[model samples]
Target: MTSAYPNGDSARDSQDVSQPKQSLFPDAIAIPPEVLARHRALVLDPATAARTKRGNRPISTVYRADSMLIPLREVQSLVPRPGQVSRSEINNELAKIGLQLRPRPEQEVIDGAPPELGVSVPLVRLEDAPADRAPDPWTALVALRDAFGDRVKHFGLDHLVLSASVAVEGAPVSHGGMVGGTPVSHGGSVGGGTVALHTGSRNPVALLMPQPPRPAKVPAGRRPVVAVLDTGIGPHPWWSKHRPGDPIIEVSQEFQDLLAAQEGQQQNPTELGPLNHPEDVPNEIQPLLGLIDSHAGHGTFVAGLVHQMCPAAKILSLRVLHTDGFSTEGSLLLALHWLAKRVESGDPDEMVDIVSLSLGFYPETTDPEKVLQVKAAIERLTSLGVLVVAAAGNDATTRPFMPAAFGHGTGSAASGVELLSGVGARNAPGHTTAAFSNWGEWISRWAPGDALVSTVPVWDGAALGGIRYPDGGGLGPWMRSAPDPDDLRSGFAVWAGTSFATPVVSGLLAQALAEDTTAKTDMVGRAKRALIATDAELARRYWQ
Candidate 1:
């Protein structure tokens, strides 16, 4: 069991004296020349360059991080504990070594301190900093590292990044971890009651995923299902028709099959499901949709969005979060693997056109651990022609969030959290990055996260099975009157964070697949580009 961990820190007793300092943190991966070229081009656009006033050279963008890169913030201190001088202080001391915090548009003031001492501020890049220079950022970081010593126990890529381990505080920050507020989607209190600013409750999708107009005939006859894998779903009015026999309804019996194969399979190949189409429709409500985890109503809420956007589309729900709000290990991988099988059936007519995951974590987790799990799942599904959309995370770090960011790997590090494709948030009217959403290396696009709206389940804890009220199980579940569509009401709320961003993208993608199943080629890249292009278009307004 200990060996299951990729870093192998669980069995620290069986020692190898040789490998100590070499790989203390994740090593920086070298970027290929081609990708770097594209990244440079994007950051140095003429209009973008116009934003810079610092280096004399016009530079627009600050940092270009990996899709899964999570930025680590260093602790700021002038007088290093008994042993060292702060890097900011050190920079101020050296007339030649002026500390440049933010550069491009404006240079930060050093406060006339010493060169040996340093202040840990927000990590800066060329676009957002005072000066862009080779080797200096690394140099400033090293000065901090030398002063901090083993207190830098945080783990991540080093040389390229200022190793997350060495900071004074030892906790690894959650890139998309800080999100959620209030409860609109489920049986509260019982299922790990949600709270604002603490990464809790009723989280979901992105907004306005641009799609080409489709013909009206397809949706007129048949509707497809958009699967959302999140914490759990509440028993809202949307799922009033849910039944007992089909407690765990899915598109087919292939759910278990997908889970089993993923446990040990390494390299992902084709994962399409077996044919199980019965020409005659069953009498019961087709178990076209499913809800998992007695406690996690998140799955319920995420799937509900699909229902709202594409009224005709069916839903295949998978519960990955436990009744206690904890999403178990291996569950996410199973969900992705399951989704791949359903999409790669060869017969395009029966495939699930869109798959949605509204979870986020650091990018490294996306590699051999989760990335292979998802990418393999995606390659197979998309090849068979399915679209997968995820949240950009609500951590709102300076860099882009994970899963959705390009080239990120997957693997759970210290916390048992699995990072998935993430969604960035946006504000109303402005649609800029929502204040609550987390950011990472690849900050591609942004949509609404703060004060967004969505649907949740309406059921007593016991009726929903084992779940209870948010205040903890002293009383029986609260039964509010079901939402009546005819009676107008306010469904939108002022919640914020990363989980909020994913559903919008998922809903939009589902709309596209439900409307035009034929446009599945290169859909993943196209969707990514569309998101960025849309944000870029919105950005034009600010510049003008």
Candidate 2:
């Protein structure tokens, strides 16, 4: 029998399900030969070129600027005790090799690193320096590190990686035997205005149903708050109509630069636009519009999953990944620092209870320093009572992925963090883990990731009919038109990935925290309990 779970090819049959699909344009899409040639130069490796034939991959674009992180504390330690080194002294030393340092923006500061360690700065504009005098970016970074030793802390190329989620086109699988009824969409007013869409029999929300009402005695102000860090949450009606004011938090200009660069636009500070709409490029060049990368609307989809389980919990949408679903290690660190700073400085109202990271990188080197830096950041966030959840990755390998793997480590001040692997949906026979989920002892839990339906950015009707695939395949649109008059595919999609599995755990933890007053004192412990309880509940309802 065909598996009930989508993407449920047995692990024995498809060992490489976690690998990204080949480029949408197996044959080159239309573009000027010169532009295509220039794009080819941008590909960093043969593997990247093979996977990104149409040049939509961020790592294969001009934005792949070489950058390295320098720990300032180590640099400061190089000077004699009680002596101070001016910024110029550092710059002058770097100038010999055509490198420079600048202060990190205040908004990116967070408790990830000790204040005594000083801020980690990026080594920028290495290409502009005289080639003969200036060594390659990596060489210069290494020379500086050797000269300074541990005082330099860590030094390496700023690497790029994509989000873990994958968006697929189709209807979601049904789970009626366990949960009952097709999932229905719900609409409610916010800010005193009626929501544009309504929940009805024909328009059931996908993947989640409202929880039965909690006891009246449950404590107020203890709802678990979830923060989603991914591509910017698009302006989806479900979130806009449910939450008053803007649903997304404003990001800093430095963050904006990262997005702009990824989109292949001018990266100057003045040229950068807001993260929500970074540029006004045409569909041909816009990654999302062209379907060059499949990660568009990733954050919105993740938020939708969290909201489905914990409708009343506060959600903070932070955009870190570009539309192409790519971000550098430096960018990810900056985002983590920004969130940690808020939790550290903000009042109780602003503190976050859970952080969902659906994105991660596979380091090129085996050095543990970079991983250690990320671990420190996670430790810092958990230290402040925030639970961190990460996707075990789509690579389907036992090789550990960072942040997710970090969840298995000890010594953190708080201990609510864990890695989630993807499993097939309810009652899917013979398939436990989703074919795409990475696995190892490090994975803390598993959740259904196949054929998950959630929110997406509503597309303008212009593209509703369909767009012809560039290769002349019959009209193959990125999104299909809604069949039911009341149901709109414009604002929803069915996708599969370990990235989605993570929020399932986050939402379950949120629901558990919201109902259990006793768990309030130790939110991290509460999160752990919730994960165990949720696993049991799923097993009872579906696994048996």
Query: Of the candidates shown, which would achieve the greatest lDDT relative to the real structure?
Result: 2
Residues 1-544 of candidate 1: C-alpha lDDT, one tens digit per residue: 1122222222444555333232222223323333233222112232322221222322122122211111122223322346564444433432233343421111122222222111222233333334554323333433433545443323121111111100001111111222244342421122233532322232233334332222334542445556766543444444444344322224344553433332213222221121122111111111232221222334554554555555545566655533322222234544655565545544544456566656533433233333332344445555544555656554324333334553232222232121223345555443244444444333333444455455544422211323324333445366343332111122211233445555655555555554444444564554444334433433453310
Per-residue lDDT of model 2, residues 1-544, tens digit only: 1122224334455555444332221121222333323222122332433221233322221212334454545434333334555545456667666777544344133334454322334454445686554223444544555466554445444555467754221112121111223233332112333331112111224435443233333354455678788776556556544334433233344545543342333344322233444221212223243322235567777888888877656677777765545555666666676677778875776677788888776553322334456767777787776778888676445554666766543222123235222222221232355555665444655666656678766543222222324333545445444433213345666566777777877887677667665636665676566666666655554431
- lDDT at residue 340 of model 2 (Cα atoms): 75
The RMSD of every model to the true structure, in order and in angstroms, is 22.6, 12.1
Question: Candidate 2 overall Cα lDDT vs. reference?
Answer: 0.51
Alpha carbon deviation, residue 498, candidate 2 (Å): 1.4
Using all chains and alpha carbons, the TM-scores for the candidates as numbered come to 0.43, 0.64
lDDT of each: 0.36, 0.51
Give the range where candidate 1 is weakest over 10 consecutive residues by summed lDDT.
Answer: 161-170
